[model samples]
Every structure is written in C-alpha cells, then in structure tokens.
Target: MIFETERLIVREWRDTPDDLDRVFEIYRHDEVTRWIGMEEPLKSPDEARTVMTRWQARYEKNEHKYGPWAMEIKASGIVAGTVLLGPLPEPSDGSEGRGEIEVGWHLHPDSWGHGYATEAARGALELAFGRYEVPEVYAVAYPTNERSIAVMQRLGMSPRGLTTRWYGREAQCYVTLPRQRAASN
Candidate 1:
C-alpha cells in the first residue's frame, strides 16, 4: 500500500479479477469517464483488465515511486475510486511534456460528495512531497469540471491556466509545490 488516511487506503492497482471488476466499474461510468482522457467509457471488462494488467506490470518494475492506485474505504473495504500520483504521460509530439509529477482521482458516483476524493488526495500528496520529495505536482481537468476544480483548490494548488499538451484537448491546469503543502503538511 502507498499510504492511508483515516477513512481510506491507497494502494497500487492490481491485475486480479476482483480488482479488474472494480476498476471496470469505476471507469465505465460516464460521469467518471467524461473528464478523463478516455474517448468513451471503457468498452468492456476485458479493456479494464488490459489497463490494470499494464499498471501491474509497470509497478512490478519496482522503480516507480508512485502510479495509479486503488482507493479503498477503511470502514467498508470497498474501492471507491482510482487515484494517481505519477508523471503525466509524455505528449505525442515527442517534445518535452509538462515534466512534473501529477495528482489525480476518479471516484464512483455513489462515493462522491463525501469528501473521499479530497481525503484520499491529501494522502497521495503527502507521499509525493514527503516520500518522493517532488518539487511540484500538477492536476488538470476539463474546463467544465467544477468538482475536480474544487478539489484542486482544497489541495492548495494554484491555477496555472490552460493547456492542450497532455491530452491534445484544452485542460485547465493547477499546480502545488512542497512549499504550498505547509498547511497540509
């Protein structure tokens, strides 16, 4: 496991059937998938398995400090979402990408509005700054995603404006550095 909060446990994504099913459920919802880079909700469980297997393989390398994680609620042992603390995917142009660590999350709609996203993100950011010692971490969302924007603000990230570099579509970017994490620290 990467870390834990009072109400959540953050761990690497697994390739097991149960994890694949949960990942599929989380990524298959339109509300969750729309703002994510996916062109549409994943087509099937097979697709979720493929993605989860890839993450398992990457984590198996044992070189990455962080990557996509499964967010499990402490009281229920239910995975309510997926969280990420890692380098943003390199841009297709082969140019230098944002070159910063990133923090991101997508929770099941049923788990929304309960502060789970914010709580789990706080734990991830702690790892990013405390363990990983990254200078800065970023977050991006579709311009219209008010929920994630609010989370960014709660995390003390400053608005860095918009960009299309990561996903080839306009995305509002926000950033936070170790200095800004003082309050959260």
Candidate 2:
C-alpha cells in the first residue's frame, strides 16, 4: 500500500484484469470523467486497459514518488477510485516551467458522499509533507465542481483564484503548504 487512512488503503494499481475492470467501472461514468482528463468517458475495455497501462508506466517512471493511485476501501476491499500526487503541468501559455506539485482525487459515484475523497486526500497530503517533503500542494478544479472544491476547503487549502496553468484550461486553483510552514507564515 502507498499509504493508509482510517478507512482507506491507498495503493498502486495493478495491471490485472480485475484492476482494469475497476478502472473502467469508475471512469466510464460521465459524471466522474467530466471534471478530469479528456472529459470523455471510456468507451471500451480496450481503452480502459490502455488507461491502466499508461498510469502503470507513470508509476514505474516516477518510482512511485508521484502518479495516480487506487483508493481501496479497507472494510469492503473494493477499489473506490484514484488519488493523484504529481507535478502540475507547465502553464499552457508557456508562461513558466513546471515547479509545482498537485494533490487530487477522483472517486466512483457510488463512493461519493462517504468522505473517502477527503480521507484519501489527507493521506496523500501526509505522504507529500512527510516522506516527499513537498513544500506545497495545489488542487485545481472546474469552478462548478462544488464537491471537489468542498474537499479542498476541508483540507484547509487557500483559494488562489483561477488559472490556465496546469490543465491547459481555466481552472479554479487552491494551494496549501505543510502545516508547520503554513503556521510559520
């Protein structure tokens, strides 16, 4: 497991059939995919496998320091969704090079409203602040994504307004430093 919270076991996603199916199940929903990635839901099992392979490659290349990870509910052993900690992309306008890290989550609709996203994100933050010593983490979401915005607020992230920095489109941005650094400032 990459990390664990009271109710979650955040871990690397395997390339097995079951894991691919779980990825499809969670990402096939337009409701969940609309706020992330291509904004189009997966159309087939082949696409799901491709997605899993891409994520797995990222995991290997980063040596697990950053990438999307599966969020498994410990009580039920069901893979809930994904939690990501990675480098935010450089500004689309070429204003700057990459230097920021981001923390984000995407959960199955069935897993929504159970506080899993928040819990899983807190676990990611702990890993970032503790093991990786990331100075700060950012989260960007569509302005209308109230649920994700709420999670950021719950994590004590400060609103940083809108930017087209990371995702190549306008996104509402929030940022937080490690607790000690935040407190000292």
lDDT of 2 by residue, 1-185 (tens): 88899999999999888889999998899999999967599988889999988998898888877869999999999998999998877778679765789999989899999999989988888888889988889999998999999999988898999887767788899998898335633
Number of the top-ranking candidate, with lDDT as the measure: 2
Candidate 1, 44-65: lDDT as tens digits: 9999988887887777664757
Model 1: how far residue 69 lies from native, Å: 0.3
**Model 2's lDDT to the true fold?**
0.88
RMSD of each: 1.8, 2.1
Q: Which candidate ranks first by TM-score, i.e. highest?
A: 2
TM-score of each: 0.92, 0.94
Model 2 ranges with Cα > 4 A deviation? 180-185
Candidate 1: pairs in clash: none
TM-score of 1: 0.92
Kindly give the number of clashing pairs for every candidate.
Answer: 0, 0
* Alpha-carbon lDDT of model 1: 0.86
